[model samples]
Target: AHGVARPAAPLSTFLVGFAAARNGGTAADIEQACATATGLALEWAKTHPTETR
Candidate 1:
């Protein structure tokens, strides 16, 4: 999502919400998912930033 259009932000949020709805959609689960995603994104950015979407 690094160089994508602004619309992608809401799309990503929707996807995450959809995924949460499929699961428990609880606060703890959401926090865990966000933390995991943040860690992975940070790692990817460090190693392969230019490959970002």
Candidate 2:
């Protein structure tokens, strides 16, 4: 982990956006998918607290 950098947004968000675009979804649809992924991440964090470094 010394040289690795985490993405600003999760990989899931990117994947969802890419899939939506490839499937002919509108820009707004992609945006909605990304937003949904972000909300899901936050909910996951709420359920599983991380330890301080």
Q: Tens digit of lDDT per residue, candidate 1, span 1-53?
A: 67344676787677667766667889876776667666766786688646443
**lDDT score for candidate 1 against the true structure:** 0.68
Worst 10-residue lDDT window for candidate 1 reads: 44-53
The residue pairs that clash in candidate 1, if any, are none
**Could you say which candidate leads in TM-score?**
2
TM-scores for every predicted model: 0.57, 0.59
Error of 1 at 30 (Å): 0.7
Error of 2 at 29 (Å): 1.0
Model 2 weakest 10-residue run by lDDT: 1-10
